[model samples]
Target: MENIKFIDQNLEKGLYLVSTPIGNLADITIRALNILKKSDIILCEDKRVSKKLLDYYDIKVQLFSYHKFNEKESVEKILEIFKKNKIVSLISDAGTPLISDPGKILINEIEKNNIKIISIPGPSAVTAAFSLAGYSDDYYFYGFLPKKLGERKKVYEQFSNLESSIIIFLPARDLVSIIKEMKEFLGDRQITIAKEITKIHENIIKGNLDNILDKIKTVVLKGEVTIVLSSEANKNKDQNIDINKEILDLSKKMKTADLAKYLAKKFKFSKKEIYQKILIFNKK
Candidate 1:
């Protein structure tokens, strides 16, 4: 094999936030490869995971483990590396670092110290999944769902009325339960589940919420899943009318402030909207 020579070897002394391939190794950018090769030391969430990528390219460099568990403690040590004027690069196990991945503490410390922080953009699961989702380009990424059912429901309720598509990360094992909760709170909106994106086993499933639930109920999903939920604008008009009627009935019995707060959570209306409606109803 011919020796691979990277261009732009004169990398500045700073912390580099490098983006790795999310699933398919070949999906990585050439610039990202060049930076990784030029890095003096690479900080990764998992050394074992990063090793495979490093080994594949025959680029030997020091690998340091800097993860959520030890991020606080690792800050001083990382800053010490920067003080040495070494080229330090941070990469997550996959995708872009700090997108639902750890690196905030170190970045904050680096910023305070006035150390340069550079970004080497590449493959990101969030953008990759969304590109294939076929939903509205206007979307909001809601990282990972909460573990507790109540907490997860609160998240769903909070974003239930968002007019743009919602993208969320979920473990395959909990897909069924999460889908059920989404149906209960978000109604049967269109959904797209992108699994193992860019890999050989990559699968894209598109359907309404109810249909998606029924399809995946019997099957087992192996990798982490990215789900895209259609915006509230796609919901049935009759459903919104029913919720409005319910809010009006509650307004008759509950105080303006109390009804506004309660209905805001149960329905999609803003508290201010509900409050104004209650005031209007009381006048009649």
Candidate 2:
């Protein structure tokens, strides 16, 4: 490996938002490494997690614990470090800082005090998964879903009607239940699951919601997961039919099963979906 020289003069006295690798340590940028090497202090979610990366390149610096639990308390101390004209760098356990990570409070304070802040961009799981998912160019990142079932359901409902692709982070344990709930509220749209991104176990599973739910049930997943849901717009345009109105008018004469069969043949959607819609429409 070539020795990359660190130029201390290039970095200014300010708080640097450094983006670390999402999974593969080598995925980090040269500029990010340089910033970390030159920083006076490094603020991170977990010192143990950050230490591994720092140890890899032999970049020794003070690692301060700065996470959601202590964000408010850490802000004043960080500002104090700034007063001494020290170069501080804030990093998350993985990926970019403040993108579902801590740092917003400190950033707001830095701006209020007129302190300089710089961003050193690098690898991000959100963009990585989005790029590989092969969904629409436009997307809405919904970060992590709420732990509570009711709140999670509300979130699904909120984005159920959205036209663009949806990106969400999920823990390995909650993957099965969450996918089941998604099918219930979001319908059977296409989905892509990016697991353990950039690592040896990295896997991308793509299929319709119904098929994905079945596939996921057989396998056990670990590490971080990023899910990309294809746009409702794409499904709508592909079918190009007002399913509600069609079900209402057709049900006036035909039985539920017969109507479902008729619509299933005429459209791209599944018979099970049409049957459910017919039942729901008639009950209303």
Q: Give all candidates' CA lDDT scores.
A: 0.83, 0.84
- Which residue pairs collide, candidate 1? none
Error of 2 at 167 (Å): 0.2
List TM-scores for all candidates, in order.
Answer: 0.83, 0.86
Over 4 Å off, model 2: 236-245, 251-284
Candidate 2 residues 1-284, lDDT tens each? 24766666667889899999988989888889889988899999999999999998889999999999999988888889899989999999999999988888899999999998999998888999899988788999999999899998778767865789999998878888888778766667889998888887778888887788777765577666899999877686535457777886779889888888788656645566677678877789
- The candidate that wins on lDDT is 2
RMSD of each: 4.7, 4.2
User: What stretches of model 1 exceed 4 Å from their correct place?
Assistant: 1-5, 236-284
How big is the positional error of residue 149 in model 1, measured in Å on the Cα after superposition?
1.8
